[model samples]
Target: MNSLQKGNGSVVRRVKLATIHLLALGVLSGVVVSLHAGEAISPRRLIEVVDISGPVVSPDSSQVAFRTEQASVARNTYDSVWYVQNTDGKTPPRRVGEGGVPLRSSAGLSLPAFAVWSPDGRWIYYRALMDGKVGVWRASADGSSAKPLTNDPADVRNFLLSADGKTLNYSVGATRDEVIAAEQSEYERGIHVDSSVPIGQGDLFRSGNVEGRLATQRLDVLGDGFARVPLLSGVPDRWKAIDLLTGKTRDLEASEVPSPQTIASALPKGESKPWRYALDTVNHRVALLTRVGDQGDLVQKPGVELSVLLGKNSPRHIECQAEPCVNKAISGVQWKPGSEEVVYTVSDPAEGMAQSIFRWNVKSGEVRLVARSAGLLNGGQRYGLEDPGCGLSSTALVCVAADANRPPRVEKIDLETGKRQVLFDPNASLAADISADMPVKLLRWKDAKGRLFTGQFFAARRTGDRPPPLFIAYYLCPGFLRSGYGGEWPLATFAEHGISALCINYGPFSFDAVERYNQGLSAVKSAVDLLASSGEIDRTRVGMGELSFGTEITMWTAFNSDLLAATSITGALLSRSMYLHGSLKGKEFISRAHKVWQLGSPDETPEQWKRIGLEFNLDKIRSPVLMQVPEQEYVWLLDSAVPLMLDHKADLYVFPQAPHFKFQPRQLLAANERNVDWFRFWLQDYEDPDPEKKSQYAVWREMKAHASNRGENPAGSRGD
Candidate 1:
């Protein structure tokens, strides 16, 4: 959901908060509340209302702290600190600090997320854009005395505090240093596509034609002491590292001189992009996750020599090269605490169902199962992806688990015994009160290309023989899966009204694989054909709901199929033309491959985009369309969606203060309750009042109030 503003500027949408029952959490203390798997959960009362973002965890796993914002239409965002005991039924969750006012340091435009407790358990370290760059800031774990950790001008990506808690090892780099350096050196190298910046600042003097290498440092815990590591030197496509402490220089890994034919042959095919290749490091062994081919490789250090980890496999022998394998699934790989055991996540898009945690011993290279998740446990849950959350101190593994019918709950599992403990149960009480409808059914159909396609269908449990009015959800994204759990409003809320929802899983979309591109678009037609044959769905009453890339699929489906009665879009694309000035992180592999991108690149594939970019083909979208654009999206979709709405006369509105990533707390609550109300009006002809529209968003209200007294946005406006 990258939304581009008018200029080159871009902003990531903050995370959203969903309601959690306070009474339920209070009752959760001291009680081992249990329910059969897949039981429907009806939240009694929101126990702890915390901003639902980031890895909200406590050091000891006893308590969890998170950012919760109170939403008001008149304001943009209202942020506050919230903490609650992580157990069953005992005490009511309480807000920390002065009443509802945010801890002074936490005030800002973005939602409060990425709340991480320091290793010492006394302070929390998070990012605050103070003093020109987003630097690390420390706050009392109880929400007090929050201040900047350093005034250095560096953008912090991730940080790690040393064992003694005095030294912090964090990775920070110049925001556009690489791009700027490359652009500066472009003419000298005559456009070497592989131009990069490496370490070694002491040797500012350059070899002929090579630019002075940009300085990258691996900071030591000691204040004012640092060392430099060069990712790329002036040398074309070379990696070298310089040890600042010892002043010794070394080559990181030598480059392979592939033949020109090999390079050219590796180009993308059709709408498919080449796979991103990387040397996967596991202890002493290394493997490559490559897009060019399926043959996997294992490499060792020093020589940077590669050996095949897996070879070509037959169709039936549990082939491991593609997914649910070591190369593709593992990320943030690390050794287990006090042991040589390595841990990683085997995430597979096809499995889309869940991510299984796997552990490999560094000493023996022996792999074992650690914890399996029903879906991605990391933030990937939103993108329908998953990764492992190793302990900050290397003792425990943190995981998130959920499925089609379950809201996720955070859990920590011990690597040694395989024992698990629940940290945050999102639906503990709801599970006790109501029975969830039957588990969603999975289906597989063969495509014209002889490939088997998989999808999920969830029907209302209400008894009746009448054909259910099926709602098809369109999906597109490299990080998410069609089967992954979406928000409660469209799926669960709609189910409560007796409408069946069918989620069409399309691939070779970004969510399935980056290299695959829009390969899955071909399958949507077949999926619709199958649904049309199903007697249980009323084809005339079908509806479509799309978010992000799903918006593309929904538009395609609606343009082609007369079955759909209406379409709802959020954080979606308005047109391919919008991508011209679109703000995508171009360093990513997909963006780098111009030829592959052009295959689906909205600009080059204008004809194709015109057919699918609902904005241009509105006449084809006879069904009333509801288009929503998040105010905080990476790209100003308003440029596209709003204009298209005006052109097609579609019903369109902006969800103020909401980000591309998540909704405001109040917005989420209202969305879950009232959004479905709007759908029911169109589907069941059920009457509901006009949804309340707030003049000011929750975030803006907070900002204006703070401005009234402080004379500026809490984060400081541009003019300030």
Candidate 2:
């Protein structure tokens, strides 16, 4: 028999007879059955879920090419694969090729660069690793053959296909300063210490300059490099055009290709380009989703407007029938085939942030709704639709759709009737393996200041008569429930472990940094009180998790209130060390910090430091904190962690070679499992029986005893 203790100090026993009976049945039948069946999602299984991107329609609009990425634990990285499927759902999606270099933007989001097809739709061209070289490779549409198209010394960052399909335009270059640093390191010359070098990068012998060799020598490293050389910004890329028929390459001028600024300049005055725009060459009109603000301002209001410019006439604004068009942005703007109608997607705040698709006739100035769903449409982990999220055919729009309960799947939506048909589901088997009908409720609440907030409430599976403990993760809750923004807290897994989880989406923020943090704190407090009042959760047993901007809010809550029983944060908090390290990046970083936080040098603004720095507020924090940070960001936490470690109030673990967003398979699994264990021990007084976790539980046990000695009750208790 096994025993578990509830928060009320009641013991529940698990009998072994049921398990024995199942085992005997399996033995008599000569088959093995799982003892733990229909449990909530596990961290290992969640990591195996496939990430789908790029349902790019073929030129003939008959087939679509997409990419799927899944974590490979043995390889410690993601395995990228490509697939092609018919738009009409007539045939199943077939695998075309594997592996590609993903294109990452400055904002750190990975763009779909693996499914670019030729004009004839006979072959797919993408950048991949070939013979230890990063180059362009092509595969037949039928998956019968594949070959390398370019064997360049430098990796091709991005490529474009011409209309005629005779030439391929590609760009390959490195940051100017990093290239110079690589050449200098080759000669054993001492590097010049300047503001360009970010602090805590490395020592002189093995500095960031040496790491630049990865970009200069091999050029196979995915995403952005670790070096923060400020001089790298604004440097133009080297462009080249390759003739497919003649097998020749020649340098092309920068002006040969249109830039974003150049394209935006062609728009009408007082109208600026948003993330996605629609250009109708046949109708001689352009449609843009523009925000309500000046051209170059950093901060803009949430309200947005649709602007249409036809043949240089005054820009006409189209208004939606759904009033109060207050939104951060809209996306997926595409021109209807051979018509003056434009289609786009927006999240209606009045409808619990439900995503809605709308179409507007530029010639008639009329707008009409196409479809509306509380779940996301043409959206993924993030809130809005990504670039090239949906491709429009003559009669239907093929998009990637998902929600809190659904993993991303390719769907074909009829343009006329708005009926949806699933074209492909990559994670159908994985979803079936971890089958459990976890209930999800969309919760709406308002803070004391009248700011409205929305959250997804996941109820505990087996709480009995007692209200379950609640765990909260912030600040964005979109699509799937794998984790919040940073993928730190496992929401569904928490529910399976008898703890209800709340994932809160942020509302509007104030301009003042202090007020912004207070707003977040208010929202969290309101959520807890709302749940407690409704008998949905126990107010005394509450925990929180966060990353990035959410970390700032978590720290503020810990400093100002006694709400959290336990807390976990990934990445660094705001401290004097972080400010100093950021200052080393450049004046631009310093200027932005001053603009946002009003932060300066510690010596210059000691008062402000005491007001906002986590190091200064360490004396007030009462909850035990778990810090699982990336290796690159661990140094910034030293000032705060060292002091907290002395008091046994915090434990820190660093993942080696990890970025702000952990993508490595083993690292992600380790972080997710550790978080689960940490909360289970603190919030539930429970531990897994696996012997591998013996030492982990031992350390936590000591920490619990230390808390008791300090006259503090264990977490999930009735009183402090």
Report lDDT (CA) for all predictions: 0.42, 0.65
Q: Name the TM-score of candidate 2.
A: 0.86
User: Over the stretch 460-480, how does candidate 1's per-residue lDDT look in tens digits?
Assistant: 654466565666664522222
**For each candidate, what TM-score against the reference?**
0.58, 0.86
lDDT of 2 by residue, 492-596 (tens): 788878889998886664446777778889989999999999998888788898777777788788888988888898877767777776665556656656666
Which ten contiguous residues of candidate 1 have the minimum total lDDT? 219-228
Q: Model 2: runs farther than 4 Å from truth?
A: 1-40, 101-109, 130-132, 174-187, 201-236, 253-262, 268-276, 281-284, 293-298, 312-329, 350-352, 379-386, 430-435, 716-720
CA shift of 83, model 1, Å: 6.3
